[model samples]
Target: MARRPRLEPRETRAEATQAFLGRAADLAAEFAAGTPPRRIRSFSEAAPDDLRPALAILSEIPDLGLVVHGPRGCGVRAPGPAPLAVTDLDQRDTVLGSGEVLAETLRALDAACPVAAIAVLGSPVVAINSDDIRATVAALGPELGKPVVWVRTEGVRSAVPATGGDAAAEALLQLVETQNGPREPGLLNLLTSTRSPELAALAGQIEGLGWRVNILPAGARVAEIALAGRAEASLVLAPDLLGLFAEGLETRFGVTRLDVALPLGAQATVAVLRRVAALGRATGGGGPPAPPRPLSEPLAGRRLALALPTAWGLAAAELIGDLGGTVAVLSVPHLDRSHAAALGSLAERWPDLQIHVGEGQGFELAGLLRRTAPDLLLGAGDAVVVALRQGLPAAVLDPARLIGAAAPEVLTEAVDIALARWALVRGAVQNARPGYTPGWLKRSPDWHIKQEVR
Candidate 1:
């Protein structure tokens, strides 16, 4: 007898919501200060934009060359396993019209860099000077013999760090727009925030269904990225951050997007595979591999904190409670309407759950941790260090290990180890000096964050 697949609660699935950029929580307290966290989404979407840490996101596209067009001290070094070119715009260049310098930089990079394509990322200085990036790119793109695109990422564009990701996505899409190629038969673009084994495994499942999958923007081939418009459909692995790319593909190339959630846990993953198979107009492929049932309440009676992206964090928060742990503090980089359903579901279950939004503000994080005092911390990026300094047993959230069939168990193991090592983690930091002044620590976590003048 053929058995039916497991059916999780409807709330665990994707909900319809709108996405906007801005002031994603630079710190969790930004939303919680004197208002309901859910009500924070009701605010206007006209907040500032930041093209931050986007270069980091772009660099991972192994075949894409990057040129950071900015002043020398704008954190412009190549945090690379990938090659990067910096324009090295000095104070003088800022005043004297840096267009010539930019043109010269592009030509120089084209000569030396042996990558598939080059992208010029703007800095706050270049953006203010109003650099004619499009004109320059158009002029030199043919001369350079490959795609040269302008990625508008001045530091202050949007307060959302993922805006950097969006800019990079658009730049990649521009590269695809340049190609006038025939669509490849059975090709699908798997759009994901990071290239993970779990996603790779999911890609394999789609491949088994006889589709050619090109995972994009992150870990995408320069060849594949250039020809993305040729794909039949775009499957979003993390829609909260990458929905823009999917929508753009649909608009520009007429590629259909399967607006699915990041397939973490078993149910979500199974749902994704079926959707793909259905889209292909074929159902003959065997059932997708089912991940084992996760242990219930692996973290029972423990208070935990999560610092993750919006969708991933909400899913993980629910999973934590399912496995027997309580998530007291929740921190995501940004929140928009696209996340309303997931956030609403979370609110329904854990009414008192502290919702904090931020990306890498250790000062504010210190205050958040003090307020929540979670037994363990699970997160990614700069926030991990802050957790360590305060002696909390912390684990980094790896997108690679956190999705697909085994994500639930993978998270459980990580959480268990973190909780078990609390004594060791705390003991090591017992003699450490405080990273902040007493005044700052005592002040509200959102003290430094300026409120919008309405």
Candidate 2:
């Protein structure tokens, strides 16, 4: 058996949280340094405030649509005025049951709209009654003969913004399964979840391989996902949401699953594609076609740093090592002492590798990076800043943008692209005159940033 590392001393929850936030601030400062790029206007912030912007974006996507439950102060904003359907749940309804109202809402939507799927964006008050709401929707789904997905968005406590995306993906998964015939003989479900636009690019890669890709939450409807069992296999690109849907596919359809690490560099990508091809062969499905040209080379002999969540760090480390890159430092937050010790032991196994545990945010992490400057950094969200400031290539693997409702393979492709871009940037920088700076590196104005709900 592999020996586990000793656990680090436990910090109080409050202390750990503070450390996490502090590190986030440092990271944010590093990456978000230019004029803010345009962002999709959120429904929560729109109308009665101008809902038109949100509506306009939604209108462009013909098949996909949004539904808001509860009255106006619910923070449920529809980007536009395509067709408004609101449910008013009172105190009595909250204490007793909102199922009747929800059922009525579903019936109305089924009758009036040609929606591919219905996403229930709940308010704080409505979130309190989520179970009742979901039961109502589930009951109404079969009755109305329409696929309804219930997303619980009550209380603004969590930092992640992809719950809506998760709900959307789950609904679409169900829809696809219901509508499609048993999974195509050798077909595989590509479990992609992420709010990032990179999903669009990744989908193209899988499709290029002549494989049928079922992008959870974004592209396909609920009926299509219900038919996922028919697919011969499932690939989990993101570790965070892997267990949930993978287990479901296994239980319902007897589909085999391959839990590969998210592909980043050239070696990792080839390894993943090869493994996927193997799974296809095992299931009697045709393997991916041979590449027209050779893929990029591995990052052997390079010094790499990783600043990411604990789950992603472990998986990434395995891939990084396989590529022949030397992992000089890893900055992870919230790891218990035993896990940290185990990680440390694993690092020791690698020649010249170093591992550090702490919140992703903090002066300590910055200090460590200053000491052991790495050639690359792989992390989610704000941690990309450290790499940027230190002049190293960095990839941001935001979980919100990587998992839940989007296509998992797309997320994998996005990571591959980010890695490719970083490699390109590094090559260009090396060729440039010493002390040359890129245009994006120029400083910009500092906009007042709002606090995200924790």
Candidate 3:
């Protein structure tokens, strides 16, 4: 029997009401009152786009060497488990120009790794110095017989962290030779993070339908990236992570993207597989997997708060609702317009779901948690600590685990476990002193957040 799609609600918004979702920039923009303000309770509702996105993609390509160019404190480490070179600039270099150091750094890395390609990541200092990296890379790339690309990762330039990933994708795309006449039938490109057993399982499922899958930045060779222009279509594992990359591919290579929600719960996963199988019909080998039955709605009547990355938090809300949970509030490290439609859909479904956007706002979260008093707290590391300390049932969910056929159940099981320990969690909360944060600060999550539009 065919199962109906879930959470496919009509897009509707209240005619008169408007709500604000906070962002990290709001907190950072606040002018400190004193030389060192009484104490800042800084945090955002969403995860900040850090250098991890840039590093994750660069380190995934096989034999790709990295060279970080910036001040010593910039900490320009490449993403992933791969090794690379770093050119730490001092105060003198910032004023005098680090051109000589950059040239020497590239040469040393090339000599050490002899890689097919080299990626240079820029720090705030490079941006400040107005470094002409393009001219340098153009001059050296031909002589080295390898593609040399630069990713502008200067923290001062962009308020959003994912911009680093965009810069990385733009650089890496230069390495792809889009001259492969036409896309091969049944070829699909997947844009996500590195290799994992869960991804392998997904690949196996797609392969079972007679389609070949190529995952980017995870076991993908330089040549494979070059051939990406020839893929029939592309799918994004996490829209927040790869939306821009996919957009670039579509713009440059004419690869159609399956713009859908992240495949988390059963219904969402089924939707993804069905779409893949439908695309596979051209190659004569796709049959949708058995439709997932309606979720039993285990979290019904439960109020929960979610502290997660923007995209994941929104999707998880829908998933939680499907399982009968109410996401009363969500805290994202940041917010962007890429998934405005999806966010809108979620908002339509849960109009009263309060959203707080900021970065590392512990005091704010503590206050909000106290006020909301949700049944469970679902988020990543710090959120877990906050909840556990407050005696709330808490579940720590790494964004990576929210994939594959079992993702929904994994989250539910964690929620169940946390709930089972309710008494213990409460005991810990009861014994703790409430003076960790002051009464004034705990009054509002945005106590120090500036009220301005960036």
Candidate 4:
């Protein structure tokens, strides 16, 4: 609500912008762990796609321009409000290197628009070509008088799409200059993906506790990020997405990160409030009293199969199970070292629940759903389309939406709505054809995986 003065964007280390290249193999390892053990196939469709997650994190800067450093079509097909440019790499450039083309694109974008910074994004082609993107940015950034940041996005290299968010986090933090004066008190930094009512509600809850929330890398301005170093602590809603960014802030600035489970259900929300209060007490403020539990029992007698990312899947599954819904299966985009504790936590509760870890491979999810036959299916993005065509009631849920004190009631109402429409959905199920063939799904969801390994 308050306006901050625009500051000059500072140039960063060329190596820092290129750091993602070194982490590519490590990023791919996130998928190595699963009940069945994940393996690369001939080809698999990224559930949410690779760029969406990075864009979700970087697109927070509505005023920034993105210079995609690959083929012309390599840029975002449906870019958010931010302006975009491309090197338009051709066969000639791929073989000979496109340094000049990248330089030219960067200059043109700087002269055309007034942007806080220009993000130089490397696509899979760029990675394959071994283009010197860091050197190009380092050479051209100062001349253009803009902070040129590199977001490392090699679609072929990253096994999990959420790793793109990690790239965006690393790149954006380069712009966060360290604070010099005393740290700001009663100021809490929150990393969240909630929009509108959910976001407004979360802010109001924090404000009621005499603390202010700075929701970052999601609709935050460059200037707002620049000032993050001054906050007392950082709170992450999507811990898996923002964990690296939080650590970067702590290392750059002295801001402590509130290491806690994301606030999904009523209990987690209360836990977050308590932690905020404990931090606020350092600034001479008290926390709100714990509220009554929103859900006393589970969802009547319904069973749910959820497909989501690791951290979100774990939290949402727990919440649903706690609320009385049988968590028959938990599907994740991928699992990595960070998920070790959460995996144990999940196993402790639902040891027998099958964990399907894969990219947003629709066929696999369809197969898992058929095998499990849960009462309801919940997941992120268009994967819900698969569930509906199977004549099962479904809902699209982001774990963030399940936050706040009223989360349980909201989830229950959502399940009720899906059940009410079940008959109508079943009636129309035959009308909509699934992308995959019925015979193929019946054959095996993981037939390709088996073939590749064999």
| Local accuracy of candidate 3 as per-residue lDDT tens digits, 351-406 | 66667755555666767777778988888778777777766788787766777777
Scored by TM-score, the top model is 4
Task: Supply every candidate's count of residue pairs whose N, Cα or C atoms clash at under 3 angstroms.
Answer: 19, 42, 22, 4
RMSD of 4: 7.5
lDDT of 3 at 205: 84
Cα lDDT tens digits, model 2, 1-454, are 3332321112221111112212222333322342212211111211121122223222222344445565555534434333445577677766665766766776676678777656555555664655455566667667766566554444442322222323333444454456655457656676653334555555555555555666543244445556677777777654333334565577666777775655553444455666776665655444664442332326566776767655567555655555455667766643432233334444444634544434323334444555667766767545665455555667776643433223233334544665678756766655555321334223211111233343
The TM-score of predicted model 3 comes to 0.83
Off by over 4 Å in 4: 1-38, 42-50, 77-79, 178-182, 448-454
Q: What are the per-model C-alpha RMSD values against the true structure? A: 8.7, 12.7, 9.1, 7.5
Candidate 1 accuracy as lDDT: 0.69
Q: Rate the local accuracy (lDDT) of all candidates.
A: 0.69, 0.49, 0.68, 0.69
Task: lDDT winner between 2 and 3, please give it.
Answer: 3
lDDT tens digits by residue: candidate 4, 144-228? 7767776767545444566666677777777775224557787788776445576568777877777877877677877777778
Better of 1 and 2 by TM-score: 1
For candidate 1, what's the RMSD? 8.7
Estimate the TM-score of every prediction.
0.84, 0.53, 0.83, 0.85
lDDT of 1 at 61: 79
